[model samples]
Target: MSPNLAWRPIRFTPQLERTYVQCMTPRIILLQRLACIIGIASFVGYQFWDLLLDPEALPRTAPIRLAIIAMFAVVLVITFVPSLRTPRYLMIQYIVVYTLLGIGWSLILAKLPNGFLAGVSGFLLGMIFIPVLVNGAMQAAVILTPLVLGPLLVMTLAGATRLEIVNAFSWIVGGAGFAVGFAYLLDVINRHAFQLEQLLEAEKTRSEKLLLNVLPAEIAERLKAGEEPLADHCGSVTVLFADLVGFTELSRKLRANDLVNLLNDLFSRFDNLVEQHRAEKIKTIGDAYMAAAGLSGNKRDHVAAIADLALDMRMAFVEFCQDHHLELKLRIGVHSGEVVAGVIGRQKFAYDLWGDTVNVASRMESGGLPDEIQISAETKELLPARYRVVPRGEIEIKGHLQRMTYFLQGGV
Candidate 1:
């Protein structure tokens, strides 16, 4: 069977227009429609009343009052068209169109000797304000004032059976006065809207950066999209466990605030070392600090990176204690193997590591003595020429068999 020619295409009708309008932001759509309707209604009412009541007595001298009516109808139709929806682009169209509307209506009033029917005058003077409110008084004036003035001057030359040479000029001056007043209000609204949009964009960017700092970049993206992916990514990471050996004595000697400040200062130095080696800071629980390279994020040569960080932390603490006339000892243990690390809690989030490697590394720290840097035999083989190490006889690591460990001094 052939396709039915009667159903070739359904054109966009009033029903389709209404459906589209409903889908747009209702408030802005309603206000723009209402403003346009009010202008058109007032213009029609005056045109009808003047032409019907007494065409001869009516003060208009325009040979083409029908043309002015058509202009206003076109303006109202343009306001609701979907093409004028781009905020930036539509704003330009709005400014140009309303500017012309303001000038054109002012000219129609100018052709009348008395310059506006009392009720229509109020609306014409009042409704001609959207442009001024949206752009600026000066801008609306510069764009529109001339379009109205020249047209009005020509319309004023029309005669009510030869009344125009003297009477219509007075109406032109009065119409110009109303345009100036309405244009000022338009400028205020324009400036205010622009400022608000700029501020909103700045706040959005600042919030994005703050989120990246709080959560890793990948986690932040998942949060924005409302997905809670597995936070842990398992891998063979190098874990480092460090603690102050004399934490008890250090806390006892200093005031509570001073102890906290000292810990903060010591940890701050350690944080720099960790970053320098591109490691993830696992958490500082009390005087104990834990870090790992290559978990929750990627790394190259994870074991060597962590060993360098551990050595730097040890030296930094020694220098800190010596400079302050306080004795500080650091026991750091590093192990390279498979482990799981992730943020574990909802509130007061903590990044923690799990698995046998984390346990063995912690045991190496607990088994270590004052001022010593210890590591698993697995970790020792990755060391470069910068660190010194000596084999420590097999030490029993909790939950595991006795494993040979090493003490890190300077370089091996």
Candidate 2:
């Protein structure tokens, strides 16, 4: 029994997608086959009529005439119908076209008097053309050569067949053969074209999903199409960095997947916080996360954005600790300065900022006390008095000669 119905409610399956494709493929193939059959029937019908009435011939008696029409009809049915598109139908078409051609043309040629050799030649030459498949140019050559040259070649060479109309119908066989072959060829081209297009659409869908995974939709599009910021932009933005203090110990206590899930959960919440303040997240390095604001097209007010986010994170982490009973703390640092920012990379591209301002922002986080928010003096200059600023005293930040730092405790 199929498991699809049993598990259908739990997950989606490829079977549904396949069902739609299945209905379409055969319907189209059938249509093309039908058109090929109809075209062949019309060409052969006109030829049979014209040939039977030719004045210079032993007239078509019922048996011979009936045989010729019957043979042609069978060939047309088998060759051009969708039912015959399969291998079984192909065998039937080949048997009919060749057998009828041999019997009918031989009879007509035998009566041509001096036409014997030309008829033989036409039969042999036609065999060479109708069977071999090549480009459309070859098909045209096959049909037209017989029409214009049948009498010329046979009569001019062997001096036979005074009936110009008989010669014309002889050549019309070439046209009929070419028409059938050409129609078949066109359908082949159409099917291949559709397959190519389907592959491209699949690729486009996969690419969209990947882009969504890497960056937010709006940002990814601007970066994808090579759009650039209007000017060499500058921004006063808040940068925030968060790192787990002893994740190595946490890793030792949990499975690899557990640690990964924990990190994913933690960072996802952090991302939500960044969004809540309309900030842009930069990147995450394992247990570390970096985010910034004002560079997301904001030329100013980064300090305020970072400040507000820093307070929210501290409160959220406190609540998380209480609920999960997991001891947790975050060191958040905020700095505001003009940073040179732009996008980078071709594959897995990212937008980033460089310059002393962004560097100072990272240092503030590292220099911060766990459970506290740290801000550089430059950041303090712009912040409102709703937050109490505690001077951490002048200290040497790593890789810096000297710097002043302060703690932004909540409002007094």
Candidate 3:
């Protein structure tokens, strides 16, 4: 039998709506500016019409034409004012500009000889062009209503014939229908583009997170910045290596999934400790976990940070064992010295550390007893006086000279 699934309804939440608006604000501002420029040009250019079509009426119409031009100018100035450029203010400015223009043009056309025909032509032009400025069909309807009806009313009052008024009305309605449809189509296209941009942003964030998980944040940024064969040499660094005791034998007795689950639970706790101490987890090899401090160039107290991380890992492992009802122990070893760190590999690349420090740290873990935090003399000398340590004498390290080491017990 199939299990029942709960599904969330798909809709644009308020947050998404606000985001869409914000994304489209620049485009809206540009359109508003374009509209203003066109309005200004049309008014200025029609001065020739005033001279040609009806020179006698220019004296009376000039003030109305200048007034409409001044209104468009005011709105255009508002668009450049950062404080005044909000969605609400832009909407108000849009309505005011177009409404005043519609009214102003209607008055001017009414004074002409062929007033009815002139008004109808003006109405048709407004219906075809004005809707592109606003976003939705409803807003287009609101702005177009005044533009369409004001001229018709003026023409009717001016004694236009019934046939002339009817013909103009049909043309006005058809133009409005076309304007509303165009606005709706633009609205749909803008929304789809907004959603696509949002998806791309989300994917970019996810990819960055995954990259950070594999590499240190600084190294990841350098890689992203196109730094090829990235590497850095540090004079001082503290490295830690930890291995789970008895994990090999325990894995043989448990199922693969169970074994992995148990390892993951313990390592997750260690990861938290690493973060708390501000140390970087280098990588894990089988049951072993490696970490480092001072890779970010903090050479002063990296040893103490790694020491605190090792101590905390032991305590966390104890709690983990008790909860899982398993017999397990953590063996941690630390060493402080210079090393080379960088990203390596063409495919499946990783950030790693190399040199004597990392190897000595690994040997400290392998040579040390279970449930103990071991440190080389170099690391021990750097710890604060509050930490209590006991000498473990000297041990012969494979492929290296014998070195004095100590077991880090606790703070005094």
TM-score of each: 0.60, 0.49, 0.92
Model 1, span 36-83: residue lDDT tens:
566567656667555554466345523334454565566567666777
- Give me the runs in candidate 2 sitting further than 4 Å from their true place: 1-213, 216-219, 227-233
- What is the per-residue lDDT of model 3 for residues 1-412, given as tens digits with 9 covering 90 to 100? 1222112112368999877777778888887788788878988887767666687978878899899889888888888898888778777766666677667886777677665565456556556555557667878888777767776776677677887788778877788888988887777666666767889999999999999889989999999999998999988999999998899999999999998998898889988998899889999999999999999995478988888888888888889999999988889889999999999997899999999888999999999999999999999888999899999999989998999999999777
Candidate closer to the true structure by TM-score (higher is better), 1 or 3: 3
Per-model C-alpha RMSD: 14.1, 13.4, 4.1
What are the clashing pairs of model 3?
none
Model 1 weakest lDDT span, ten residues long? 1-10
TM-score top scorer: 3
Per-residue C-alpha lDDT of model 2 across residues 1-412, encoded as one tens digit per residue:
2654332222214673354334344653454345345434543553453355554454533344456656655654554555656543443454445455445555555454444444444543434433232223343343334444443444344444456435545554555565556544553454445556767989999998777556655677776687865223565666777776666676788888877887777777877888888787878877778888877564366667777777887887777667656766788877887777666776556666687877888888887788878888888998877778899978678778778889887754
Candidate 1 clash pair list: 132-186, 132-187, 133-186, 136-187, 387-410, 387-411, 387-412, 388-410, 388-411, 388-412
- Candidate 2: residue pairs that collide: 146-171, 237-302, 238-302
**In model 3, which regions exceed 4 Å deviation?**
1-11, 115-132
Q: Candidate 1: how many backbone clashes?
A: 10
2 or 3, which is superior by TM-score? 3
> lDDT for every model?
0.64, 0.61, 0.83
